[model samples]
Target: MKAIHIDRFVSNVTDLKPSTIPNPFSKSSQDIHIKITHAAVTHVDLLYAQGLHQNNRRHVQPPFILGTEYAGVVTHSPPSSSFPPGTRVFGGGLGAYAEQICVSEPTIRRVPSQWTNAEACAVGASGAVSYGALISVAQLKAGETVVVLGASGGLGVVAVQIAKAVGARVIAVVGGKEKAEVVRGVGADEVVDYRQEGWEARVKALGNGGEGVDVVYDGIGAVESGIRCLRYRGRLVVVGFAARGGKMENLKVNKILLKGVAVFGYRFGEDSRRDPQRTKDVWDGFMNLVEDGKIRPVIYKEDYWGLEAVSRALEDVRERKAWGRAVIRVCEVEEDTTEQKARL
Candidate 1:
């Protein structure tokens, strides 16, 4: 089977190459085999390729596949498994940039018939992360005000829409005019260009009575600014550190203490691993929003057509040329359009 193999970490994503690696091996009987048809390109993929991601620094060595999330068809399953062979599913796992993957049955979810391969693949863990941060962890409420950092990225777009879907006013903070436009199209009530000076003041002014926002979803590691944007007893959920180049940021505990705010570090993968059932509930509820057209995975417009384009796709994300989720069509398949048009 063909895959983007990382035999050893390199300094540049361009140095990675495709290899005909052996078929994936299943670790247990509960693991089902999938034939990957589409996969999403993410900043994590870029970091992982260059050995800059935390997993790389701590434990994950090379001689592994490069991608993290995918949509595919089940080719083999254990007896009486709910996901029988031929079921269409989308999920996250290592080695997703390959022709095939083997993951635990509990980890996969059935793809909605109305969803396109691109959208399904693009979803990856963004929905789960947004759901966990906004709904589960932060307990964001309707009629509240929330500020979403990195609002144009895949996960941030989902967070913006989820906040709107729950009847919250969203102040989306992005780096430029293009990203600001992207967030607005997804239902942001207000867009703040962080590249502009005084953006923090602007966000605070838009919040309740010019006090501060009810919640801050900080996926970009702008911890200090996020705390400043929060209202009294506001919730700040730290999702990622993409803007910090994957490096964790130091927070001012005095700011948090003075504001009487609650700070949370949300790791969707770790949370899911620790509490699988609760994670499934969150994911299932999030999918209900997608099925009802309340939320959709925001996919980048450019078409990356094959596995060979994986490097180019990563570069596109790294360059911020593809604002939303960038996906690669590993293998083409006819999509069902019977229910409704795909929310691309």
Candidate 2:
């Protein structure tokens, strides 16, 4: 089978190439087999490829497959598994960028007919990360004010929508005017440019006076003013550290202590490993929202076809040129509005 291969760590996207590998599953194996049709390129792809991510249970040393999100049709499944042959499904697994993937049946979720390939792929893990942090972890409540840092990236875009869907007023913090616009288009009540000197203060003012926002969803993982942008007892959920070369910032323990605030670090990979049932529940809930039109994956509408186009797609996401979730179409895209937002 053909799959994406990383020769070594601390490398560039140019180093990523397609390579032939042995098929890990057979017709009677317990694992489910899927022929990937769409894959989402995430910022973590760049971080891990460059040898920078902090949390790695297996201590990935490269010379391995690279990818996490995939959506396609099931080719084989045991009768005990509800996902039958030719079933349309999407989920997260290591080395997901390949043409074929073998994973446990629990890792795959049946894709609803109304969802497009891009939407199904986004729901695999990235969108669930947002839902888990906001709904499951943070316990975000309706009518509360929250701020989403990096509110225009892949995870950030989903965070903004999830917060709004739950009836919370969102103060989206982005890096520039263009990102600000993207946040607003997705239902953010206010957009604050992080580049501005007083962005944190902007977040505070929009909250309930000097108290600040009720929750701070910092996917950027910077203690860079995000710690001070929270209300008294407001929760700070560390979603990720995509900025600063994937290295965590030096956070002030005093801030958490003195502010009487709560700090939590969230990792989707770790959560999936420790709690598969919770992972399924989160994915199912996120997919339900997508089906009901309460939320949709805002995809970066760019033509990415064949495995050969993978590098360009990764580069587009790494360079932040694509606005929303970056997806690679392995087959022909069938519809609009279901997966991707209209490109202007």
Candidate topping TM-score: 1
Deviation in Å, model 2, residue 240 alpha carbon = 0.3
Once model 1 is optimally superposed onto the true structure by TM-score, how far is the C-alpha of residue 77 displaced, in angstroms?
1.9
lDDT of 2 by residue, 1-344 (tens): 77787777746786677788887566456788877888888887776676676644365666767887888877778888888876788887677778888888777787767676677776457778999888888888998898998889989998999889889999998887777888889999999887888778878988986678899888887654776788888888888876766455887689888888888877887887799788778877776777777776777878888777778888887887877777887755344333332210
Task: Per model, state how many residue pairs clash.
Answer: 0, 0
Candidate 1 stretches with Cα past 4 Å from truth are 57-59, 334-344
Measure candidate 2: CA RMSD: 3.7
RMSD (CA, Å), candidate 1 to true, equals: 2.5
Tens digit per residue, CA lDDT, model 1, 246-274: 56777768998999999998888778779
Model 2 earns a TM-score of: 0.90
Q: What is the C-alpha local distance difference test score of each model?
A: 0.86, 0.79
| lDDT of model number 2 | 0.79
